[model samples]
Target: MHQPLDIKDKSSDKNSIKVEAFRKHVRTTKPHKHNNYFELIFLSQGHGTHAIDQEKIDIQPPMVFGIGKEQIHYWDMDAEPEGYVMIFRSDFIMNSHDKALLELANELFSHSHILLSKDESITQFFSLLAKELKELTVSPYVVEGLLKALFGKILQMALHIKPTQDKSKNLYQQLVDLLIENKEYDRKVENYAELLNTTPQNLNAICRKIENLTASEVIAAHIVKEAKRLLAHSNSSISEIAFHLNFKDSSHFVKYFKRHAQVTPGAFRSSSLIEKRN
Candidate 1:
């Protein structure tokens, strides 16, 4: 069975940092990305294609990959793949701090919609942070003190990463920002290309080059993801989700879900709830 992408949709205040770390062995392969949290992966062991957007970058052990919310990236897991992941809300970091980090946070991982911070010093800091994080799972109240230190340490390390290449990413980022604002609208790729003052073929080519999927596919994925969220997190029925998504009817939405997700809306919700219980 395919698991939904690892998306942390939990809430946290600006003053508090909520974090969790775990090790998992890969039993299957899938494409997934976070929609609500920033992710830092300490790849302790494993090898896989870190497919960011549409571009597949080779990932090796002992490297940390940082992914931001709205960044569509995933790992096609291989055997014995284990890692430490620390995810916190972006509110945990401030804009002044963002100015401090500058390109480090932005370039950590990049494709079209996202860029990850990959500075050597920041990577090392997280290696140490991951060790400390493992301690919190056992010791408990250590969370508050350590969380502050971790954020500061990250800011410190951000100083070392160089500025990133902006020309390649700017256009795609605009498209994704537009996506965040207008998921309810059925905006075509041609529409985006025209808005960007480029040809449909050029926009499609760039999207595929950076994200491994077409612009249309990315929008459809968001629709499916939102549908799943409403299905699992709310009391809204299938018809409501379909209608809310502007589908003609429930049948249309059902077929749409099955084509990409390989599971009925009801079945997906039931399985997600079961996972929560376990």
Candidate 2:
């Protein structure tokens, strides 16, 4: 039988932010999930492929990989890797009270992999960020400022490399950001509309215009995607996963998952395990 998925809790009780140089090793890792934190991996050097969920991305140098809070990913490296890994939990961004920064972070994490140019400034930013975090006398404000600059520079580079359809912040973009930022597991359009301070009808219109899906459909897609990730990547029991997603109970979640995924949660998990084993 295949082993249970490895769920890593990298967050410490005290600090919500951390930075460190990437471990140098030539390896393949089992499919695993991280708990309650987003990781940004900046690799100035590396080779092989990174599997994020169902997509396999080639690892090229000078690239930034954003692993979302609940994504299932694994590394398959043919050569020794050299880089830095930056981790920050949701609370670090949410509690900052900077909506723009929070949205920017949400956008950054939305993309699984972003190719970057070989700019010395990017390396310098990471170097300075690591130094600030390592210094015992460094103030929290200094660390936060450095982080802001680093993320801003990365985002700018990502946009320059590949621009999205609409660069302006619209209602649809705000809704997308709110869905990711708010971890309430609320799949209701009315609740999201309330949070967005708009009517459900208006929200639905915007979603249809942007994604060709209704507002309720969009919310359900987000919840179902997260549910699938947990089922496939975490060792959490069905009941535990249900509670984590704020479902009324396991039965309700099972029905929801079956309806959307067209497979029972247990069967899905079993299949995921089988695939990994092969």
CA shift of 106, model 1, Å? 4.4
Backbone clash total, candidate 1:
8
lDDT of 2 at 84: 88
Q: Let me know the TM-score candidate 1 reaches against the reference structure.
A: 0.49
Error of 1 at 253 (Å): 1.2
TM-score of each: 0.49, 0.76
Candidate 2 lDDT score at position 150? 78
lDDT, candidate 2, 19-120, per-residue tens: 888989745888787867889999888899999886789998888999876678899999888888888887787677555565567567667888876647
Q: After superposition on all CA atoms, what RMSD does each candidate show versus the true structure?
A: 9.8, 4.2
Single out the weakest 10-residue window by summed lDDT for candidate 2: 161-170
Give candidate 2's whole-model lDDT.
0.79
lDDT of 1 by residue, 110-163 (tens): 422222344454345556655655553543334434544444444444434444
